[model samples]
Target: MPPRRLLLRGVLTAALVAVVSPFVHVIDFFYRREAEGVKRQKIANMRDLTPGGFIYFSYPQTGDPKIDNDPFRQFVLIMTEDGQLRVYSRVCVHLWCLPSYIQTRRQLICPCHGSIYREEDGVAIEGPAAYQSYPTNALPMGKIEVDGNGDIWMVGVDGRIGYGREWHNIKPDELVRRV
Candidate 1:
């Protein structure tokens, strides 16, 4: 190779690295940093949720109107038989399609590719999904509290009032009683 050509190639490579490194660092920084200024809203009281049942709620903490702007705002709350409560994002790991609960199967089934997730822990039971589970956003359950009136309050991951039934809207009355 000619010396001039080699020198020009080296310079171009160095320039590309210099231009790309900062952007990569910035992306990494954002990914590593925790979401700030999030608001909380309580969607349901512990008493309201029956064991072995699940509640569907929206992200940015249920009911918050601001969550409507989030393209990825879907979530579910599951109350296990052991009284443990967990929240999960509804996006399927296989192809990022939204999954719906299959009542007959008692699991969340991704319609796009037949992926099944355990309602209890969001573990992938079967299908084309490579990940063992769905992705979950940070939901601070510790701040959830109920008032004397039995109303639920929760702090949402996003900085907004957790409001609305469209996301986490399953009411206790609507669920089929577990035998």
Candidate 2:
């Protein structure tokens, strides 16, 4: 190969690698992360949330939200149309961007790509998830059960915890039945 051509190829390869490296890290961070001390955190009471209501809390988050947004543990608890209380993953299936509830439309809209999801069903209605490129369009929800104390206890996650993994990680001390 000519000297000029070889230099150009080397430079292009280096530049391409630099551009793609950050994207690879971003995707890895989204798809996979340490479960980070999986615990059934008590965020709110059943009466605190109205029917067809939503609330945000970061489980596994000890830092101040004003300082940093911990993407992993941010979750949304949704009161369904039939009065079932469920805590669903706020991460969008397409890009893993945090979605917020749109009060007027009563839908969860992804700020990243305008992905719309039915807050009740956790099903993707529009945007990148409409075509269903990901494994499951429906967001993974953690099971919230009313314990003997009448407080909402997040029992286990729907997807990974219920699939093949056991709930052994939840220590006995981690569970506090206080409202």
Candidate 3:
């Protein structure tokens, strides 16, 4: 190759590296950082929980209206037919659309893309979410425990909430727009 062509190629390669490195680091930073801990919030009482029914609630209670009321923060607590309690975030993994619980069907269905997930464990059963890679295809879940007093408290979320791979990595402007 000509010396001038080689020099131009080298310059372009360096420029590309320079422009792309920062974003790579930023993405790496988000992936490496630990998730923000969820606040232990009492969500429902077992005595009040009806079997095969659903209860809606929110988590973390960040106090910032944008974060607190963001649709992604919404969750559903359900009492399975076997009497086990499970909680799953309402945010659909495919497109961040809220999935509605169909009690009769025992599944969470996303209206946006018709993605369906098992209500028992938030596993994507069909549609686009089912076709995505692991975890991305699964809905975000919150860990809950029931105390002796029958109060159910949400202790933590299995993964970051919302549209992205990391919940904390969501764009602030999107949160503002969502709110």
Comparing candidate 2 with candidate 3, which one achieves the higher TM-score? Answer: 3
User: lDDT of all predictions, in order shown?
Assistant: 0.54, 0.64, 0.73
- Models ranked on TM-score: 3, 2, 1
Query: How do the residues 1-179 of candidate 3 rate in per-residue lDDT, one tens digit apiece?
Result: 99999999999999999988878656566552323534678887888877788898767666788877778678888888777677888888887888899899988999999999887667788999899876577776666666778788877776656642443433211211100
| Model 2 Cα shift for residue 132 (angstroms) | 1.6
Q: Model 2 RMSD to the real structure? A: 12.2
> Cα deviation in Å at residue 144, candidate 2?
1.7
Task: State the RMSD for candidate 1.
Answer: 11.7
Return the number of clashes found in candidate 3: 0
lDDT of 1: 0.54
Going through the candidates in the order shown, the clash numbers are 19, 0, 0
16: Cα error in model 3, Å: 33
> In model 1, which range of ten residues has the least summed lDDT?
157-166
Give the Cα-based TM-score of candidate 2 against the true structure.
0.61
TM-scores of all models?
A: 0.51, 0.61, 0.68
How many Å off is the CA of 156 in candidate 1? 6.0
Candidate 1 residues lying further than 4 Å off, grouped into runs, are 1-37, 61-71, 130-179
Greater-lDDT candidate between 2 and 3: 3
* Model 2 bad stretches (over 4 Å): 1-37, 62-68, 160-179
